[model samples]
Target: MASLSFVNVCKTYKNGLTVVKDFNLDIKDREFLILVGPSGCGKSMTLRMIAGLEDITSGELWIDGQLMNMTSPQSRDLSMVFQSYALYPHLTVYQNMAFGLKVHKVPKDEIEKRVGRAAEILHISHLLDRKPSALSGGQKQRVAIGSVIVRQPKAYLMDEPLSNLDAKLRSQMRVELAKIHRELGATIIYVTHDQVEAMTLGTRIVVMNSGVIQQAASPNDIYENPVNKFVAGFIGSPSMNFFPVWVARRGEKICLEFGKNKLIANEICSKRLVEDGYVGRRVYLGIRPEDFHEEGPEEQKILFDVEMKEVLGAEILFHGRINREEICVRLSPNVKAEPGERLPVYVDMDRIKLFDMDTEQNIIYV
Candidate 1:
C-alpha cells in the first residue's frame, strides 16, 4: 500500500486547452479515494497521469516518497483495471491471470499460488478454466479485478471498472470491492461520473469541475456541507433546488425574502451574509430535497405550493414552488402527495446554505 500525491499538477493537450489546473490532493495509504466529476472534467486524465499512461505536462506525481515525474508505467508499481475487461478471449481465466507473471518469467509454481489465492479471494476459483466468452459480464469483471489482485501492487487505479454491468450486478460488486479492499489493504484510486459510486466507494471524494478541484473531503462532509454551488448540486441525487433571494430589513428583524414570503435566516447565516459585503444584495438560497420537511413549526421556513411528488422506493420527493421558485422535500413513503396543490413545507433553518449569486462561494456563517 502507498500514499499518492499530486502537487501542482496540470495537463494541457496539443491545442493548448488546459484540462487540469494546479490540481493537488493527498491520498493516504490504504485509502479508497474517488475522483468524481462529469465526463471530460479531467478525472480520467488525472488518473492516466498517475498510471504513467499520459505524461505530465508539468509538476510532479509522487507515490509513497518517490518522485515519479518521469517514471514508466510499469515501474510505478501499480495496477489498473479499466472500463473494458481486457481479458484474453482464447486464454482460460487462469492463463489470463497468470499471463503477466508468465511474461516476466516468474516461476510456474509461484504464479499458480498467486493466481489461486486471487481467484479464491475474488470467488472465481470455480471458473478458472472458463474462457472470457463463457463468463457472465460480472464474472468477467471479477476476473479482471482478480488479475490485478494477483500482482499485489502498491496501489490500484480503477477507471469506471463496474460501469458496464447491470444495476444489480454493480450494486453487488460495490460490496465485493469494499471487501476486497479491506482484506488486501491496498490503496485504490477510483474514477467515476456516478455520484452513487463515488459516495458509496470512497472514504474521501474529490469533486472536480472544468479541470479544477472544487472540493475534497469525506462523503458525509461533502454531502452535508458542500463548498460551493457546483459541489452542492453535483453530489446529490435530483440535485438541490436553487432560487434567487434578496436580504432585506422587514419591520425590524433581518430576513431573506423569497417571492411573497419573508423567511428568516439562521443568526449565523444572517450575520455572515449580511456582513460579507452582500447584505441586502441578491443571493441564492440553497436547500436540499431532504432538508425540506412536511412539518415545520419554526417561524423561519418558506412556504410553498406542492407541484409534484416523485415516490422513490421508501422515500417521497415532494416538488413544490414558492413564489415561482422550485422547491423539493423528502417525505416518508406513506405521505400521499399530488401536483399543483398547496402544501406547507419547511426549509430547515439549521440545514440551510447561502451562496453568493455572483461568486458562487458559500457565505460561511461566522
Candidate 2:
C-alpha cells in the first residue's frame, strides 16, 4: 500500500478556465477516501490528474515519497476503475482479469493465482469463464474491480463505478465494496456525486464545489458540524432548513425570532452571538429535517400547514412552507398527518446551526 498527496495542485485550460484550484490533500496508506460533489465540481478532473490522465497546470503530485507530476498513466503504479467499467466485450472474465498481467509477461501460473484470488474475493469465481456480454450489470462491475485487484496496485482510483447500476444494485454494491476494502486493506480514492456513497464508504470525505473544497473530514463531522452552509446543505439528504431569523436579547438569554415565533438560544450560542454583536442582526437558522420534533410544549411550537407527506417506510417526510420558504420535517411513520392539515413543530435548539446571513458561513463554529 502507498500514501498519496496533492500539494497546491491546479488544472487550467488554455482559455483560462480553471477546473481545479490549489487542491491539496494527504491520503494515508490503506485509507478509503471519497471525493464528492455535484456535477461540474472538478472531482473527476482531480481524480484524472492523480491518475496522470490529466495534466496538472501547477504544483506537485506525490505517490508514496516520489513526486509524479510528470509521470505517465501506465507508470503511476495505480489502478483506476472508470464509471463505464471499461470491460472488454470480446474477452471472457478470466481473460479480462488476466489481460493486465499478460501484457507485463507475468508467469502463466502466477497470473492464474492472482486472478483466482481476486475472483474469490469479489465472489465472482463462478463467472470467470463468462464473456462480458453474458454478465449482469452488477456482475460486470465486479469483474472490472477484480481485474484491478489482480494487479495489486499501490492505490485504487474509482470514479463512480456504481453510477450505472440501478438504485437497489448501487446500494448492494456499496456494501460489497466496503467488504472488499476490508478484505484487501487497500488504499482507495473514490469520486462520486452520491452523498450516500460518500457517507457510507468513506473513512474521510472531501466535499467540493466550483473547484474549491468545501470541507474535508470524517462523515460525522461533515454532517453534524459542517464548515459552511454549502457543506451542511450538500451532505444531508433532505438538506437543511434555512430560516431568516432575527437575533434578540431578552434578560440574560438570547433568542432567534422567526416571524412571530421565538426559539431560546442555548448558552453557547447566546454567548457567541452576544460577543459577536449580533444581538439585533439577521442570521440564517439551519435545522435538519430530523431535528424538528412534534412532541413539545405549545410555547416551543411553530405551526405549519402541511403541504405534502411522503411515506418512506420507516419515516414520513412532511413538507411545508414557512414565510414562502420550503421546509421538510421527518417524522415517525406512525404519526398521522396529511396535506392541508395544520401541525405544530418544535426544533431541537441545541442541534440547530447558525450561519452569517451575508457570508453563509457557520457562525457557531466561527
Query: Which candidate comes out best when scored by lDDT?
Result: 2
Local distance difference test, each candidate: 0.88, 0.92
User: What is the C-alpha lDDT profile of model 2 across 1-366, one tens digit per residue?
Assistant: 999999999999999999999998999999999999999999999999989999999999999999999999889888989899999999999999999899878999999999999899889999999999999999999999999989888999999999999999999999989998998999999999999999999999999999998899999999999998899899999999899999998887898988878889988899889988889999999999999887976655787779999999999999998767789999988789889988888888889999998889898873
lDDT of 1 by residue, 44-90 (tens): 99999999999899888999999998999988888899899889899
Give me the runs in candidate 2 sitting further than 4 Å from their true place. Answer: none
Weakest 10 consecutive residues of candidate 2 by summed lDDT: 296-305
Worst 10-residue lDDT window for candidate 1 reads 294-303
The collision pairs in model 1 are none
The numbered model that scores best in TM-score is 2
* TM agreement with the true structure for every prediction: 0.95, 0.98
Give the C-alpha miss distance for residue 36 in model 1, angstroms: 0.3
